[model samples]
Target: MLNSLLRISQKTALTLVFGLFSGLASAQATTYYFSNSGNDSNKGTSISAPKKSLAAATALAKAGNKLLFKRGDAWYIPFGLFDLSNKSGTRNNPVIIDAYGAGDKPVISNLNVLSDDGWENIIGTTTWKHAIYGYSKALRLFANGVSKYKVNTSDKLANETDVDQPHEWFIKEGVINKNGIVYMNTGSSLVAPKNVEVLMVGSKPVVLMENTNYFTFRNIDFRGGSTSNIVNIWAPSANITFDSCIIQQGAGSGIQAGHSGQGDLTTYVANINILNCLVDKVWSDYENDPNILLSGDGIFMLHAVEGGLVQGNKILNWGHSGISITSYILGVHGVHNLIVEMNDVSGGESAYTHAIDMNGFEGLTTHNIIRRNYFHDYTVTGHILGSYNQIYSNIFAGVTVTKMPRHSHQGWGVDWAVWRYRGTGPWIEAHHNYLVNNTFVSTEECAIMIQDSKANPIAVSNNVIANNIIYNFGDIAIDVNTNVAGTVIVQHNNFWQENSTEPVARFKNLGTKDVYNAAELNLVLPQYFRGNTQFNPRFTDVAKRNFTLTESSPTALKYGGTTQYTSLLGEDFVDYFGKKWDPFKPSMGAIQYNGGD
Candidate 1:
């Protein structure tokens, strides 16, 4: 009897344990569907009966639930998406927001249209006015899905009677007890207020993740935002991801992630991945405020981010820099271990911007990698401004198109600058950077330049530049300051200037006010110069911007050995066009010269 009782107790304990795990599994399997045609009162567990709004679905969400929006549908939320604060998921079972039953991805915009009868004509003028109550400020105005020009003067809405352009608008903000007004001159006798929409900047983002963790968003089209980016992930959040999405048309950045306050590295947003997305048109003509620093960026990893990956994104037509990894705050913990690879960034001539800019405080930012990307048609290719950063195997081209008409600075292919500010903390300088195995072509001025913009004597030091092919440069091929002479290494590079009379390298002495050429530079700093030759790289095409090497090119065997660079870049890494590098002997430039020479 005693043996039978013990067996029964053991069986009951096993049954209870199994029941607890089964309950937890069922709780995690809850899936909610959202559609425009569904009713909210029904159970939202199936596609047949779905929820109608994000608020209802958000209220029912748990740690591992999936919230799927039906494709070919549009939702306009006046306040943007739900605020995902303190609503998190585990690493294995993250909260998901995606599309289903697709004809196209679901569109989520941040605007509210006025009714047809919501407009009133202003007295003795062709302009019409719409009064909006309880909103803070109007950011952008759209008529029939087209952006309108905003008047610069704030007094034009209340005082001007001769505003005649159909696409011009003005916003008069509210005072202590008044309502904000939006005025527009449609220049038509019949006013269609229903076709007009306004995006308000009420300190909200289209999709906000603050202090939340483990969320994945995929295949959603996000548009029409104001103050912040389309998707903003603030700090104390980790493992947030965005994949295969279209993010565009914002007054601010496209996608921004960062941490602020007290400079604590422990509170950083960690492991954020943005992959395979289309980010375009991230600037607005109405954003003329000089105080707004975070505008028109394709992807911005702001002051503090750790282990972030931004890869495979096509960024086009941005008004400012394409990808900016910056830590602008003083005494803040800087961005660390961020990898940016395989991106195609192109900008128009109207906007003078850099393809990539890494701005950070010295000794705080380190170990960031930039590799295998194509940057074209920008005023500057890159501004590498951090310590211990490695930039390799990339192409920086097309700054010579129209000479990017700037008054303050000359256009260069790659610029390395250091600035030192007087502070109580450590001195800021650019040191121990590696720029190797790259191709630079068609720059207006020098192909590569290093200078202390603030004119600090010892601001830049201990950098390496090796195994590059510089073709079709305007002025000097390589320009370095004299203060960084003994500490920098310039070796194993091929250079050919568009003007044949220019020197292969120029070392400017800031203190003595003298310049040194290739032979003169070799005499002064013989230890820093090795195997640098002046040769034509023999590119396949120059006018059409095809930079592949010809079979007879002399640069095919110019790289000396791979023993020094292979340990910096790991053993298994591909070249620019996905060709493997020979471990014993690699080619000179970004392309690995697969054809026989």
Candidate 2:
């Protein structure tokens, strides 16, 4: 009996000792500080004794630790921090990289500033020459913190003017072991070498994470990458979050996640969050190359990604698409369940670009949600080949497709706000997509298009376009080809044209048939074409792009009521201004008018 009592006492003591050690281990998670003025030999636990470089801090970092950099300083990380791979943190305690002090977010860049005296004036011309490196064809140059225009060759310098100004540059190749010369012309002004910076392009990303999980990067400025992506989260990476970060001036994309090489479901990247971020000025070599369909994008998600959230971001000046979820390899399950909402995008600055390009591997992208986004001054809003996607409550304005003079043989025609065209591959049809409660205003072309060439075998079918406000479109309201006549159901919407005595809702080309009158629409598709009204929506301001309805508008109070496609609209009934409405009695456009009639 005494021996049994001693064994129980020993077990209890061992348990207590283990608990104490676990608590100590949890408390030992440290906060490493980084500053431009500190030394690597100093202890990085405190701000006063901080690590001088990202290499020093990353070497000593463990899971559940914080890596904080000084707010006003900057670091030139030519080689990325590769030690972050294979790091995992717990759910409650994520490995965070954030700013510590005030001023600005810490800048991590690959841009090298040029010296002031290295420039030599080219005699008898308004140009200057500077030697950067040995004959590299790809160099991203910025003058006075702005991306400069790169001409095709030195002979085309005079012809390559930018917006009525003569500011362009060209690069000359050098011999082996010799430096290449960069020629610059600023319209007769002397070039300042100190104001210029360059990022040598050799496919080097700033942040490359492989199998890293549960990491959060906040309030950091990542810029000037010469690679395909500025921040790349490789395959099998999960739970990575980027909040309030500025990702700019990449040769390819701002952020590219997931692996195009992975095939298995378990090896897919998952739960990547990009919130409240600004991605600007991502350019690539393929942007102007007409032979290549891919362009430099704002955010590019590769194959085998699931359950990611991209919200409250501003994506601007992208060369191709603003956001792309793509899969290249066959037999791979594509990107799905990505909630992209409340983002402001302006793109299509390069050849044949769309705002959102989901026309990747056929039949792989499914169950994606694109809601409440504001797209303006772009060519196309969505070039979708995906299925079972929900696109609702979004505003598409100023969709003007630019005509490229170089690719004039291609005849880059106008496109609609949302285009559901034929897929590139076999057995992949665009089907079962939903577009509900959206607003289209001041578009250069039509509002919505569901069409394809007759040669494609796959049929676009089972799509629903309901409860939308198509107003002030330059061309037709809804254009559906004869090939997809009976497939799409268009109903319960308000359509109006600006400044016409007879507001003939120009919903046209349902198999080459135009339905100008409501009675004609009812006669064409009698069962589905109910409650579609053609009247002025009575907006508060059209110039300011505000689509809020007035109190006396009939579409706001009377025409919009119960929808037949209730289940198709997602659970979120919030409007553009963040006001909730009853799902059963939803209003016509993106904004639910709350005022009494």
Candidate 3:
């Protein structure tokens, strides 16, 4: 029988060559060093003696280790909480926690550890000295002992004027009463009890990963502290990465992930990648009403986060909405691949804000991509106010939107009807987004607001509101209101109203506007248009608000119609201020402000 099949193929080729050389010698690559002055019993082996916290080298790191630290080391380590759960690393041995040598040196400070030993006043100091007395009662705050504030009230007061009064106090308990005292009508702010003495001596979180997976955090520098998040990453974390870190201040956030409580299935944090980081200020520690300062949000992703990539960060002085990816309540869900590219958000000193606030989430902010960013002085720059959020090629300067009144004597028409019912959820699909060739000099209102309320139909098709160049004072450039049945298809845009007596486009309908082509079911009307060549985009200098358009400006190439752009590159036509339109003559509107020969 052919010599017994050649001895069973030579014993299966020597067991596949010894299992590929023992998996290439067990993939070796380990390097640890923190040295806040070494010796956690040494032998972390660099030359036989290196380990000094990062929680003793992340508890003897595994999957292709590499901890580093050193460079100017301030290490600190006391007000604890650095849980990275099971821990893992791949993508060629990732698991780095960098920072060693080279400029910006080293300075990890406090690391959340604060215990000057005080606070044993066990609820004393004249009964917690009127910083907050707790009415609707439900205040939870923690650090080393873990818990990071959780207020739930029906009525609560310690003294920030009996919870700032105007009535909304649902309070339930989780008060640390820091006492910097600004809590009027409580929605955020009151931190400063010396930054709650580093979460009252390590109550919890200064980096805590729940169901861990591949991770990487480079160039660290998480200063000051109040914690609710300075990198939280909850749920089953997938391939996570945070490079060039700096995440500042922190009363509540500078990078956070999933599970805003109230669960089921518990979808873990998905493939996250936050690059070139540097978030600033950061607030929201909880006082609920001393006079109202509350409001702290900067990169917070909740619910079921899927593939996320928030690139090149440089967020600034935020107190709310500088990047909020939510899925807030009701059966809780989130989907689609999300991406917020090349970021450079700015000073959003909150008062009803947005520098990028995608809410409720569905179809995962649809084909998400907010590219080439550089938004300025934000109050509202790219807020798809929650349904199908897809904003592209950004670059807005001095953006503003102040309609206020959520409850302070309420009226900006009830704050635009509470900002149009804040969109109740699930409508997503704001198509081919390319808020075309951007450049807004000084906005105060209406830069872009597409309304569709009949229970969210969200299909604002083929968007390329081309070559934008606005400088409005009170609103109206593109505002579509579809009170019911919904379908917002505002075509081939190019509006230049540098205060050219306002009004460029506005369509009103409290109801009765029909548009249904559900593949030939027929009955369309709701289609507002104002095609190319409507004149006056001329502003080489609108009194220093310069909106760039003057070259016999009738808005140049004078838009025609054949609208179908998912960011067509070859035909030139690049508007939002980067100018370039007319690739062989096809420049009508939506940017191509003549860079094209």
- Candidate 1 lands at a TM-score of 0.82
Flag regions of model 3 displaced more than 4 Å: 1-32, 35-48, 51-74, 77-112, 116-119, 122-142, 145-249, 252-286, 300-308, 311-319, 322-338, 341-355, 358-382, 385-522, 525-597
How far off is residue 135 in model 2, in Å? 6.2
RMSD for all candidates, in order, please.
10.7, 10.6, 21.1
- In model 2, how many backbone clashes occur? 0
**1-597 in candidate 3: lDDT tens per residue?**
211211121111001011111122125567777666778888665634667877776785556777877666656443455677767665556577777666664545444333323222212111111132312222223232222322222232434334333221222223453322222232223321222313233334567787677668788876543446666777666777787788765655677877656456446577677877878753332323334443556787776677667876878666566677766544544634567665777754444445666645334444445554666666544555443444543555566543443313210100111132345544443444445445455565656656454544444444445434444424455555655234344444444444333345554652433221111111223243333223455555656544444566663433332335534532323333334444444344333444323
Using lDDT, give the best candidate's number.
1
Q: Judged by TM-score, which candidate is best? A: 2
Please, what is the TM-score per model? 0.82, 0.85, 0.33
Question: Of models 1 and 2, which has the larger lDDT?
Answer: 1
What value does the lDDT take at residue 373 in candidate 1? 77
Model-by-model lDDT, in order?
A: 0.69, 0.67, 0.50
TM-score, model 3 to reference: 0.33
Task: Return the clash pairs for model 2, or none.
Answer: none
Task: Candidate 1: count the clashes.
Answer: 0
